[model samples]
Target: MGLGLATGMEFYTFDSVNLVLTDLTGTLGVSADEASWILTVYSCALFLGVPISIWMAGHFGYKRFLLGTVVAFAATSIGCSLAPDLDIMLFWRALQGLAAAGLVMWWRASVYLLMPKPQRSPSLMRISTMLYLSSAAGLLASGYITDHANWRLIFLPNLLYAAGALWLIARHFPNQPKPSAERLVSADWPGIVLLAIALIALQVILNRGEIDDWFGSAHLRILGFVGAGALILFIAWQMSAANRTPLLWLELMRDRNVLSSALLGVLTGMILSGSVFVLPEFLRNVASKTYSATQTGQIMCVYALTAAAIRPLMVGFIARVGQRKAIAFALVMLIMSMLIFNRLLTTGTPGWYFALPLVLYAFCLSPLLPAVGSGTVARIDQNKLLDGVSLYMTFRQFGASLGVALLTILISHRETLHSARLFDHVRHDNDVTRTWLSTVSGTLTTHGGYTPLEAQQASVRMLAEQGAHQAAAYAYADAFAFMAVVGIVALCLLPIVPPTPVQKK
Candidate 1:
């Protein structure tokens, strides 16, 4: 189950890192800022989805749930591949998220059910190891697909994989339907809708904020009100009901570890998701690195190597030193890598430059999350574990959305500011500036056969483009710095409390 699921999930993090948005914006001609909603919408869908999915899984048999999820997931990938417009793309993305969350929740429940306590240790290791390798493979493959083939080709392979998986499960895995009495129809629909509304509205505001110049544009302004209203209503709805199926049961908040993990997952996922979103695009497009299939694979391959190498060692370490300590170290590595990222980021920096720190960060991160997750979910009541994992994963999903949106926003904002600053120095103010501009203009005119005057204006536009690239690079650096601080604060805020001096969990 672990191997099958891990292989299926191998591509989970790629959409985040490979930055399908860059292709969507640059190739598909979507607006630069609007493109981020591709990620934002997917994540927000997952934010409120995992819990509902878990309940349905419990109500239905696990095998049935898994099979159904993959079917939906496969179909949606096909739809996403053929989507013609941004709005249509968003709808497919949401469906994909829904299907994905269901698949993952069922896969995890299956793993826990199949493996005994002792076996779970090594089984978990195998799953983690496979996930790292497959994720690296997917990232590299996606990049190559983007470069050589159409982006849609990437999903073709997924469709084949999912179909095969679904077929095997249907044939081999028999489902034993549970008693209807055990599965009550007690879900809180109002809370669910409000939460979804809140998340969707907020995503719209963030993703479109940069392109619309924050609130200066009316879309963002109205979105702000909608997001705020939804959030307020969501809180009221959750608190007002003395219900059995609160979107997130308030009783679960009694556990500190669960609450901490839920919050931490959001931030940690943000850093991971956002970095993956921006860094690769910056490498390939901005720095002009030649990322042929092998080379692009190698960049992610390095990070995977580090994750593979460190995660196993931390497996034992997590058992011994505990999750809180491991999370702290992971945060330190994140900070160190972000510092390296902040200082070394430049338009001229090569692909190989980010290798060492990237590896370390990957290593620290690979095991840190599973460990923290185990600790957090361990706090939940035994019966409510499905709910616990759902909540944990949900926040992590939202964090990814917010992270991408914020990073995109930061890149947009800083580019404008820096470009404005540099334009002053480059404008046609003096002989040197005018000659420099005209020379660039002359080259364009000669190459494309434009008039001398037309080329001059084109040259100015070209200069502005370069200025924006440089500004974006600087902004990327600053964003990494802020991400590092968030890591540090998260690490320190939650102490690795003694585990009641108990034996291994």
Candidate 2:
């Protein structure tokens, strides 16, 4: 449990600090688009690494693999802190993602392996709570550090957390024998390579598409073709390798409960991770009011606390209502929360305006994950349980990757459209526009200690800035509205998901 908490902290330390991107960009002498690769590469690596790690864990024994990854994560953190260029930082971040790939998987899998069946649910709930709390705390801690210290310093504290995790694992974890040689040699190497190629191409296209002008650029076109082709081939390979050591558990997709859970995991991943990626960026860069990392972290905590507060009720609620209905309730709350977010968006809205919807979102999302996960594998064949868990988690991480890509593209595209529309009315010949400009100039001249020409220039710049800000704010609102619609569509799938008893395990 202690090791799990430390790992969670290590994962989230970059979450909030990434919000203050201007700080990072300025320090690294990179454009904002390039600086974003710091996150993109990590996610890409993580998404591609999960299934590989799962198999590796079985092959090498869980204890050694877990401990080795922890050490790698610690070493990469030091490299990230010391990196002097964008390429170097991205390299280290990708390595960190590979090292951190199966931390959550190991923690969850350990519960089932180490405890009797009756103890697993409560233990999972407790660990889930700790993980969520650590995620929230990470944003807050990063914000505090970014405000008081340099951006490089944000990576420093992970060393301590990593050390603690190492100590716990080394002293307490038990050893297991490695898998047989035949089992190791039968691994699906080609399928793994195809999946990695597909995901890497997709990530690059998503992150670079807008800047490269999407289909207009040959770079994006080739990547799109490669990603599409590789994905199709990967699916074919997985289906053929069912008798071998397949990377994906292709058989599990035939189960209704597992299939539904995987689909919902995609949506949940999109919504939760998308919110984290977009909200802070919007608040700091697009919104009119300036929010420091600390203030943004406080807003995120509302989500974590609200989620934590509702967790104690989840197990009982699912037991009484069934997993399908519980998920239904969660979908409703989640949809309503997104609607509230769309309704409350404004360039200069009060802080509380954002808090209400986030809290509501927390209530629904907190329980939704555990319910879906437990239900997915509850009645599965004992031998296939590991495959089910790995598939469910891999899809969830893939969903997160999609969410970030979608939101990034949507925000950028909408901002351009909104800015163009808003800028159309800013003509000198328009009486209302001229009057506002004159008024602003006069005010600047009188109170800002500026000459007439200087005041006029300042007024023009101010109006342009305001227009850009308002456009960006509208773009964020559009993204939220899209999420609300997605939730509604997900709600429609509820009838297909049969009710499973919560305590069946």
Candidate 3:
């Protein structure tokens, strides 16, 4: 557990570097959409690597695998920090994703192997809490760093964290064989290749959709076919490999509970990540705060206190009220919270209004984190725990990816349409408006120390910026509308939450 907590510190490095992919267009020469490959590529690598990594862990000792992964993960971070170009940086990011694939699979398996059944949940919570805290820290801190200093500094801390994790595992963890108490899975290279192709191609298309203008662009058109073909091939491969070492364990996804859990995980990710993506921009531009200040403000919310304040209460609720009811109640809080936020948003609103909704939202989100995960993965066949955990983790990661892509696409489209509509009837001959803008421009120039033309340009820039934000406000509201729909849909699936857990074998 200490090792888990120690290894989790790398999660903190995000506070330092989280916005690199988002802001890289301004920082690098790539197009806004092209820069997103950095994110999608990593996800693809992780999806491809998970199964293979799990299989290898069985042959090698547990500590040995964890230590190697830590080293590889850290080394890639160093490469990412020093990357001279976008393409190079993306390569390093993908490598990190591949190497960082199964840290948790091994950790969970080891815990169950080493510890008693009754002791497992608490130990798992310790690790989960560490991750939750680290993530909160990373997002807020990384926001401040990106605003004030350099983005590369974010990657530096991960190096240290990985080193510490390596030292801990090397010194304390025992070198033990993979338990044969459960059934052993056979390898399926053909299915693995097909699945990798499907994920990579599909992720590429989704990641590039917004920037490439979706199907309108030639790049997306080609990738769409590539993705479609891969899916077809993967489906065929799975059909034929049902009893063999299939790329996907064909029977696992067929389980009603497992399918619902995966979908629920996806939905959970979609909302959580959309908020993360939109919040910083909203605070910095719409809320009239500096980048660093915007980030600092979020830390004061209930998100920072979730593991400490929320989790214990949730555990109690589940123990007393029951899991399904607790989850349902939490979902209610989430929807109500979002509604509160949507209602309060206007041209100008106070910070307290934001806080009220955020607290409610985080409170609702808290229980689902543990409840959803524990419910989804715990009941699976013990031997296949590695695969089950890997799938769940992949689903969770993919949710964030989907959220970022969808939010970005929607935000850009809405902003453009609204900004265009705002000045549709404007004329250069409107003296009052022109005079006001000219005066505003002149005053800005004199106060800001620019030439007349330069001041006018600056004023124009400001106008465009304001217009963009106005557009974002609308997009954000719509995004929440979509989120509410998602929440409703997920809630409707409440029947998926069984009265008791799946019977563990």
Candidate 4:
């Protein structure tokens, strides 16, 4: 039940942003660009705060920490719902991110603490199933609320989940005695500060760079430099620091299996995050006929269902063929999904056309997520497991943010390029352009009883709209092609990851 609440709340918070962002812009009188910071700030705060939270949880017992964070998370969700301006919302969202980081860390921590090492894989599989279900259901539920009720009610699911989480923790988990003040104060404050600077600055640059014209904007250039320098300093400080409470437990990387799994974690994040970001935007804004939020959500639920169905087979396949081979097969499915999209995406493509690729993508996700996560900490020292998991998740979150930003930039640049090239071919002197314009003008004159001048103007406007649609379609196709190539490269890397050693049941 604790796991259920955690899974539900995670999906609710993340999916809430995508499902209602368009409505949010109108309700708050903010541009879409401004609205994007809601998710960006949440992710940035989570990435920077997770390692610190993991370090501190040892001082403050997991049960207390989990309950406090859940309550705080619920409170911030309410605050976000009530926020009247962008600044207020952003402030609340940052706090929400901090609380969410703690909740997720404690969620995994609880799993590790309560169960024996051998029992963990099965437990993880169950938790992964919950995650997939919540992801499938959360978006549809939020979209329904946004359409029929209020956008604010989109967060109601988090409140429900948090209430249940609080009840379960309070009832079942015992609170340990608090550590001494000295123990709390012993954390490496300098390392924490430097790490925060690096993570937050990098996220800000990625989230806002395209809108600000990339490096052309002085602000982004400054952020890029700060992020780079701070990242270098943070790494140096962690490696050489004599502090007993270092920000990251660098020793976790000594285990080759954990290191390889961490890399796989990053790719898994990129795949899932990029899909969540792109599919909704493409359906909502760029489809030949725009789809309603609820419709898009329902379609995406297909991906979730596919994942859930295939999960039972994944563990057996891993056991039979080994983790390395399992991951390789999943990557092939992923590449197939992306290639299908590359060939099929177009303005004229039907809504149903997305189902096949989405299912294949889901097939990739179901196996790889559990495989990488279990393989990552399978051989780690029990005392260092928390740090290892925290670091793994932090990398995954960073990859998620990076993938979304990169794909957004790619589509925007490609759209502009395609639009310009298309324009050159559709000029007034072109015979095809002359014939199309004449046909459109004649139709307008006959049907709408418009004058020649008005008909010609309307005809030109329609042609321009169609051309823009075609350009966007081409851009999306190119983006899909790029992702397919990335998947293939990821598959090629599988040969280097060592297989999990045999274990007795």
Candidate 5:
């Protein structure tokens, strides 16, 4: 219960800000682009904070660290609510993200440390269900709150969630021996610093790359060089003999099960997060059925609920059929779902056309984390379980960031190409174009009380608008096609994942 509340709260906090961006822009008197930094900074801080949280949990014990982070999360929530300006809000949001990282990491670590082997898979699925529901609820709740009340009120719910988590954890969590001061002093500060530098640069690039025109921007180019250098140096330092206790256990990647699980984490994360980012934008701006924020949130709730409902069944199937076969099936489902999305997401398609693909995608997502997580935990050394989980999670985060960046670039590039091709046929020289424009202009002049010249101009403007929408529709379809390709790649790699151990009958 404690883990569920804490995890849900963290997920909710991460997502709730999505609906409130417009409100913040207006109330805080910041531009839309500037207001986006509120989210970007939080994401960067959250990723950077993950490694730091692992180290802290090791030193301070998970229970104490969890409680401290909960309190910090609550405090930061209050700070965010009361923030007077954009700068203040961004500062508080960054701290909130750091607190959230600790909360998420420690809660999962607690499960791994405390749960019996038989119970871990089900427990993880339940928590994952809560995560999906909470994030979905965040979208709906924030939209409602933004509609009915001040945007600041969105952070208030965290206090209630934090209080419940703190009470439950404090009363029931197992106690652990305190670490000695020597352990703290021997911490890998150099590795920590390098990791921080690398993550910050990488996250900033992921979050801002589309806006900044990616490699074309001199700023991103320098960041790319710096991030790559730091990552390389960090790897070299970790593998060196002088470093007794590394921040991350690089050697753990040698285990085939661990490596495969981590790789699966990357692939699934890309599909899940990338689709979430893309689908809403498509519905709002590209699809024929332009949905309001509330309507889009409702549609997303269906996806989340379907995944939550099917998660346990999928986990049970994985246990019966084994991870390799189960994952192969899921990948096939993913490919089919992506293709379905590509086919259905057209400029004239109705919103209901997405339900089938969403359900299929949900089925594809439901089994992945639990199967991979359980397989990883079953295979890794008990003493190094936390390290294994942290590594897997970090890979997942990186994959999600990469997915969003790549998909964004793909959509933009494809839209430009599609728009160019479409507009090329709209010239006055083309018979089809001339006839269509003349018919529309004639109708406007006859019934709409427009002058001949005005009707012609309006007809051309309408055609341009329609063409733009069609281009966007084509671009989104191409995005899903790209995802289908990714799914195929995942399917091809399934052979690399070792079979789960046979149970004694």
Candidate 6:
């Protein structure tokens, strides 16, 4: 329970600030793009911290490491709340991400390490539910806070979550002996440096790619080569014989189950994170009737709530049908949900119209992570479980970064394409365009108390804005279609995932 709360708090802090970015921008006297660095830095730091935490846990003991991270997380939360400017806030946010990485990774790895094989599934389910609820609540809470109170208040709730998690850990968690100096000296410093360079470069590219015009910009072009080269070198260095102490054990990927699970993690992360990013933007900006942040939060909550509700049934379902078949079924459902979004979503669609598809998406997504995680953990050597878990999570984070970057670019390109095509049809020579403009101009003249010349300019401006909105809607629909295609690719990979071992009752 304590572990779950700590994990929940990490996810909540990560997600809650998303809705409050505008508030941060206004208060900190930064541009919207600058404020986004708050999130970008956190994600990058979290990714970098995952394997390091695994290494530290091995030497320092999981109990002591977890407690330290929990304290740091709480302290950083307070720091974030008290930060007077963007630079200070980002510094604290990065530290918070590092603390979160340790807390989340160790807590999850501990579940597998401590639980009996049969009990692992249920335990993971409970933790995942906490994740779902807390993540959903973050959006809701942040939206409300931004609307009614100070944006800094968003970070304060982590304090209470941290306090509860601290009590639970101190009371119930077991203690371990101190670390050996021999093991401490064997750290893979080279591999760590390479990994950091790769992750930092990749994160910068993903976060700033669109703003920098991608490879069109000389800086991004340089970053692209550096990031790609670093990743290649990092992979080679990890697999080489010269490294005595490897940060990440690449040999784990030799197991078919582990490899498949990692791939599944990537696919799930891509779709899940991509949709989370897209939906709110759709509601607030692209839709005909814009929704407030609170309203958008309410709509998104349906997805998390429905997933949490159905998680128990997933354990039984996976047990009965096995992991491969269960994931295959879920992938099909995921594709279906994406198609539904692609087909039904439009500028004029109502919020209620999304409820069914969101529920369906939740059902499809709930079974995936736990099912794949349990299968991977059960198959790996117990001693290497932490390595496997960290690697899998790192892949998922990479996938999330890729998805957001890809979709951002896709939306921008498609919106431009769609707007151009729309404008092409709005010419004076087009009969339909002329009639519509005349109607709107006449209406504005009569109802808005405008002169003829004023009404003509206003009607043209309204027409251009409407065209922009429709183009955005079309672009979002294309994004969903792309997700559906990604889902199909995931479905194709299900065959490679080994069947879950049948546990004797």
Write down the TM-score for model 5: 0.90
* lDDT of all predictions: 0.69, 0.79, 0.65, 0.78, 0.79, 0.82
Q: Which of the numbered candidates is closest to the native, going by highest lDDT?
A: 6
Cα lDDT tens digits, model 3, 373-467, are 66665567766665566566667666756776676677667767876776563335777558767987889777878888888887777766666
Roughly what TM-score does model 1 have, to 2 decimal places? 0.87
What stretches of model 6 exceed 4 Å from their correct place? Answer: 22-38, 82-89, 178-186, 211-213, 503-505
TM-score of each candidate structure, all chains considered together: 0.87, 0.94, 0.85, 0.94, 0.90, 0.93
- Sort by TM-score, best first: 2, 4, 6, 5, 1, 3
Alpha-carbon RMSD, each predicted model: 3.5, 2.2, 4.0, 2.3, 3.0, 2.4
Mark the 10 consecutive residues where model 1 has the least summed lDDT: 176-185
Q: Which order, best to worst by lDDT?
A: 6, 5, 2, 4, 1, 3
Report the Cα lDDT for residue 37, model 4.
Answer: 77
lDDT for 223 in candidate 2 is: 89
Please say which candidate is ahead in TM-score: 3 or 4. Answer: 4
Q: Report the candidate with higher lDDT, 2 versus 3.
A: 2
Q: List candidate 1 stretches off by more than 4 Å.
A: 10-13, 16-20, 167-185, 211-226, 239-241, 288-297, 427-462, 496-505
| Deviation (Å) of 469 in candidate 6 | 0.9
lDDT of 2 by residue, 341-401 (tens): 8888888887768888888788787778877888777778865777787788788878877
* Residue 98 error, candidate 2, Å: 1.2
Q: Can you write out model 6's per-residue Cα lDDT over 94-156, one digit (the tens) per residue?
A: 898888889767777888878887788888888888888898888889778877888789888
Residue-level lDDT of model 4, residues 1-505, one tens digit each, is: 7766765687667876776777888899997667777777777777666777865676666667778788888898899899999999999998988888886666676678678977776776776677778878777897788888888887778888888888987898776555443423367787888988887787777767777887899988899899899989887777784666677766677788778877777777677677667677677777888887788888878888778777777776777777887788888988899889888888777879899999999888887887777777777777667767887887777776667666777888899999999999999999999999999999999998999999999999999999998898888888877777777777877866887765456
